[model samples]
Target chain A: MLNIKNLHVKLEDEDKQILKGVDLTVPAGEVHAIMGPNGSGKSTLSYVLSGRDGYEVTEGEASLYDHDLLDMEPEERAAAGLFLAFQYPVEIPGVGNLTFLRTAVNAQRKARGEDELSSGEFLKVVREKAKTLQIDADMLKRPVNVGFSGGEKKRNEILQMAMLEPKMCILDETDSGLDVDAMRLVAEGVNALRSPERSFLVITHYQRLLDHIKPDVVHIMSNGRIIKTGGPELALEVEKNGYGDLLAEVG
Target chain B: MADTAVLASKAPVAEKPRSVLDARLEALDLPRGGFTAAARADAADRLNAMGLPGKRDEYWRYTDPAAFNAPTAEPLAFTSRASTLFDEIEQLKLVFVDGRFDADASDALDGEGLEISTLAAADAAGDHWAADLYGKLETAGQNPVKRPFAVLNTLAATDGVLIRVTGKVSRPVHILYRREAQDADVTIHHVIRLEEGSELTLLETGGIAARSNVAIEVEVNKEARFHHIASKRADDAKVGIGHVFARVGEGALFKSFTLSVNGSMMRNEGVIEIVGDDAVAHIAAAVLGDGTEGRFHHDDTVFITHAAERCESRQVFKKVLKNGADGIFQGKILVKPGAQKTDGYQISQGLLLDEGSQFLAKPELEIYADDVKCSHGSTTGALDETAMFYLRSRGVPKEQAVVLLVLSFLADALEEIEDDRLRDDILTRLDEWLTSRASA
Candidate 1:
């Protein structure tokens, strides 16, 4: 459901090229894991797709379900069914978590020409969804991500994903700061949302997260381009041998 | 009034350079008759000594006193607000039209554990309890710093209310001001006393007139409680200056909060003295100024003194400005020699929505006691970019995101309101203003 071809991007304020002619695609109902070392542009790909600022796409194109993703604003992209789970969730001091969730949900609904949920209906659905993610009433009442533990923030992100129900989900290092149990909970949340009409693109540096989510395909990226593509077992190979051997083999 | 102004200008005092103070007093009309005649005369003498505030004055450095010192208020097109604060709550309502008490619109001045009288009526009587307290606290407040406008208000205020509380008042007293004349200039003074072991809440709202000067002198006696909530309504061309001078006795509690929306110029000053041990006092304000609608300038100045041991005082002020709006804050906390264990906190913050807007703040603390804990902080900044991106990424529109951030910035000042319903009402108004302007 997501496609990218020759995506070349660079820092908008400086003369450094980040992503050099990267190309990849993930089809519907499948989870793809992108494994890469530092400065490989794994995170930059997600940011470019999500329409973040401070990055200029000099060449190439990215699309979601035939819709031009880079042509829309951040909020417009979300209404078009693209979600990015951030590695670090922001702490908004006075905006209550539940209030934020409701606003986001209603805003998207309005943009899509759908009837917005009333407060009562929203509370019921949110409570049910939050129960699965183990987010308590207090967390919902508190300000967004303020004073939240590391695991709680990750789970909160997953909760937002469930609520939004995007067509394409991109997890940018969701497992970076999570413990073993927290990682399992997050993976379970992701696995539950898997459907034939939905797709997943997971960018991570470790196979620990792949152990629970079980990706359908694995891609080894180095120097801003995907160099190797294979089955899920490819992740295990990289885990055992490391990227040093893969770069040498490619050379 | 013009004739009166002319007559006052030709007074016996020597004419020296026709200074701003002299020119201002020349244009002002002093009250001719009142039960406060003696107090008015005394205040007039003091006012002449101090003179009208000049831009050169230390306290007036950040804000110009030219508008306030002008004799005639500039005319404005009056537009009634859609709703009034405290509309849902049942209470005693006192209405004033351009500074004159509307007896027909006001409720009967009789209630449980309370005594209320109009200053005009009290002036006709020979003796009254208010005569003893009227302008007393204000006279005491004019020390270490000069507040010539408040002194001028005492001598010029023609009508107001005098309230006395002997026990817990069942319902709050609501004072609602309304303006009809476009160029109305009004001066109003109120004196309130809470006797020992008594409690009372006072609510005020509306922009009294095109130009207004108001003063409320409050005395919270031993073991008493006094709560006040007021608002300066959005009037694009309104200029208002208000003051509250209060004295807290042993174990008493005093709290005051104000919400100010768009105005041409507004200056609210508070002078509080905690006299008895263990008393508590708090003063806070949340201001929203948007110069795109009109010329917006707001200033909040406060001075609090701790004279007794173990007393606590707090000053919190927050402002949000955009489109070239200007905001100023000057606050100070002073602890006396024997006032050990005094706890005082002060914070003033401004969130400027655009580069054109500006905020100026001065926070000071002086402690004669070695064992006091007094801290003050001031900051001015724009909205957090990372936080803005976070909100926008979640499908919240840019305008809605801005409204959320502005409200968040003002939450600290709103938290000072003790009543949930009142606080919520103020929050609703703030939200409505931000949403409408953001979309505009």
Candidate 2:
């Protein structure tokens, strides 16, 4: 349910282009993995879709369901059932993890014209979601991502995704800092959220993450565009040979 | 009291200069007759010599004292619906309206191992212990700064409280100041003494005068403990000028925290002396100024002296300013020559929410003992962009995210409060302030 048509993006301050006439779509109930080499505008696609600032969408039509995603603010996009698990989840001191999540959940609920959750209700739901992601109560009590290990941050992000239950989920290289065990736990958490009503766009630089989650569709993205589209066997081929032959074929 | 020409000439009690402060002094109704006569006369002579702090004064460089030097401060009224702070806590309450003590509304003046009396009620008690400690700390606290306003309060204050504690106080002594008079240019003075091995917690809120000057003198005796918390509740039209002079005795503890929000012009000054060996003192404040009602200016000036050996002291101040509001902090830690093995720390930080807001800070550490460890720091900046974005991307609106970041910046200062419940109470008011003032 995530669609981008003729997408073109540029740096806000400079004229340098990032995403040049790329087209991609992730249909409902499907998990699509976009494996790319470094500096292939993979991260830019995720950022632009999430409505981050400091990016000029030169020409694009990005939409989620019936909403014009590009015209909405970041929070509005989140309320419209969009979630982005960051590549590097930044540490924010002073805001306790529980309070941060509660504010986020309530803001989204309010934006969607839903009644807010009581404190007790919020604590219960968060504890359940956190347990699945191996996030203990102490982790929920501390400041958001402050003093957390890379694995803990990724788990925290998954906990957020579970709590929000967004329809269109975009995992932006969440496996970068995570170790083997952490990546499996993260994948399990992400895999749990997969339903017929939910879709995923997992942007990864390696095929190791897709091994645990097992994407339904694998797209070879190189030089700002998806050069090849195939099934799960394609991820195994790239893991065996890397992007060398794929880039050569695209060139 | 003014019979001797030599005494008046040396520190001319009547030969005052023509200035805005001099005019304000004329309007003040100084405590008259009986118990206050001698102290009031001496304070007048000192104030007459010093005059009021002018706009040109180095200490008032960032904040123009001229706003408070008029014949009478501008009257302000707060019509907000938020309830008063500390209303839920069980404590003894003393009410004052328009600087006059409201005896009918106050609690009974009887407690275990403690004695409490009004300054007016204690006028006839010649041997009262308060008489010995009254104005002593204020006079002793004046060192590097010429505190003319405190002196002016000593000479002009009409009514106040005198408290003495000898054992641990079960409940806090809350002074509830409610304003009933508009244009009430009231001056007040309070005297508190904690004897050896005693403990007391004092809570104060509201009743900051429309155009008010307040002075509190405290003495924590050997091995005694004293805690003071004051919240100058948000009243945009109010001018709250206050001073606290305290002395911590041997092996004693003196801790005070203040929360100031939305005052049009507020200047809070504190002078503390660690006079006894191994004494500990901490002073902290959280000031928030969102210039919604106009230019909100808050100034906190503190001077802490380490006169005894092995004593420890800390000064923590945090400010959140927006909409062109001004925040000023001047803190100094002084360690004497024999005050060896002293440990002291001071930090003042400001978070300016918008481009128009301003924060000015001056931190000083004067150490004479080579063996002591002391440091001071001051910084001013806006909220962290990464932190702001992270909060917003999580679906928190920009306004709520800003408040969250601002409060996160102020957590350290709030953590300095020794009591957990009191800190939470203040946090409630802090959130209310953000919702009401910072939303714009």
Candidate 3:
């Protein structure tokens, strides 16, 4: 379960609030979608929740599984079952993708006091998960995100999330820069990881991604606060009517 | 009483030789009417005039050779003892101890199309090519900022391995320079000649645990290809100084990769001259300085397109300075006037892991040709903060993340090596060293 109460965040050394007294809660076994227009602080909220540096949390309480999330470091949060699928993944040369994945997974395992996986066992699990994401074995052998296409990088992120198997996941614009086929494959990979004990926060500007991984709840965010909460039908309404009408309601 | 007197006269009395500097001069058996001997005399005279390079010298500013004045390595003494490192290499091994040829420890020259013998033997067998190409590429009495060590090597070197690849020698030739412990100084001069249209790979490993000085000269002929890989793993308590001079002829290709890992104070100077048109030269170096007192320095100068057109030269240097150690890289590329369409690129990069660690990188490009594409760049920086954060976010410990980043920084130089097995071996050794240091 994930909970946020009156979450207030602002850029360091700036007075402009990005997440203004926001409140949200996601019980296990549900997917939540946050939709907003450009400059609505959608990405800022994700970064604030992930505890990236330079985003000062002015006032708020965030908890994952009854543990204070704001007190944890980035790595500690990751090991605590919090995963953020980056919108723009970093390119790391000379570090193989599989090696990076194994290092991350084993690091989380070590932090959780679990035994480390052997090379053979890690490879076996990675190959099996990569099959669903349609990532070739050679791609994993190459350097992390080096020479990977836009869609391939997105898919690789999903592959990592699947490999990590985090309890709570945040997909940040996972559908951006993806063609129809790539979007379908990525959505399928996300859909395959869905379970009753896990939760996801899907952030996007378009409603197309929601068509594949239908969310149990849809929240319309504007001016750094959620103004509307409805069922899945709200997504279709926004796709057809656009945010212009929603802006009026929020204002 | 008469028998005792006779035995006393015949016994090998090991008198503590005079100053290593003086003993080196006395060991030379100069031959008459020989161009090599005349060159040696000229170099010795020039060395006497210039004297030893002090800390004030511009070239020796960063690396002071005066601290290495210990009288432990004597020059020009042939011994039966060979280096243990050569036992692992399966090739034609030539052992040189104290700047002289150790024939007893070396194998006989019986390979087909491969003339593996001493430089003196080659000259005696009417091999005029050996003498003609000896000092062709070295900085002899020229270079305003002269390297006294090179001058010393030229004057004091007695005999070294002279390998001629008449045809394509499939197996590599290993040259092992093993320095024994004695209360004296040592200087060595080596020459390698590859005939026209011949190709060979030469692996040179310096196993000098004692305080010693060494120099090597190599020459490659027209259309000949040579790959030279040199590794230095000297003792941590001793000082090791070495200089390598190479001449690559027209239409020839020469590639060199050097790895300097352990030494108290080590300096390797490499000079490459591309004399012929369409010639290619590549030089790569990786030095690792650890411990609080270790110091390593590398100075490489390359002269490209002396009289040739469309020649290519590349130089890359990577160093990791840890603890309170220091690493320096000085690379210069020279393109002559008539050498049009010359291509040259040089890059030097270093990573300093500690606050007390220091790295100095200077890349200079001097060009006279109008239609040349030459560029040189040097970068000195700490580890990437974003990358470090990303790795840490993935649950990798800080130390392991640093190791990965350091390896990534050095991967370019290691990947430039063409030999897969040698490259892998070097990488493995580097990884082991890094892991140990990380734990420490």
Second chain alone, TM-score for each candidate: 0.94, 0.93, 0.82
DockQ of each: 0.70, 0.64, 0.47
Report the candidate with higher DockQ, 1 versus 3.
Answer: 1
State every prediction's TM-score relative to the real structure. Answer: 0.94, 0.93, 0.83
lDDT of 1 at B50: 59
Q: Who is ahead in TM-score, 1 or 2?
A: 1
The regions of model 2 sitting more than 4 angstroms off are B1-21, B80-83, B124-126, B436-438
User: Residue B35: error of model 1 in Å?
Assistant: 3.6
Candidate 1 chain A weakest lDDT stretch, 10 residues: A87-96
**Candidate 3 falls in which docking quality class?**
acceptable
**Highest TM-score, which number?**
1
For each candidate in the order shown, give its overall lDDT on alpha carbons.
0.89, 0.85, 0.75
lDDT per residue (tens digit) for residues A18-57 in model 3: 8888889988989999998887888888877777777889
Query: Could you give candidate 1's per-residue lDDT for residues B137-184 as a string of tens digits?
Result: 898898778788898888888789999999998688999998889999
Worst 10 residues of 3 chain B by lDDT: B11-20
Number of the predicted model whose lDDT against the real structure is largest: 1
Interface RMSD of each: 1.0, 1.2, 1.6
Clashing pairs in 1: none
TM-score, structure 3 vs. true: 0.83
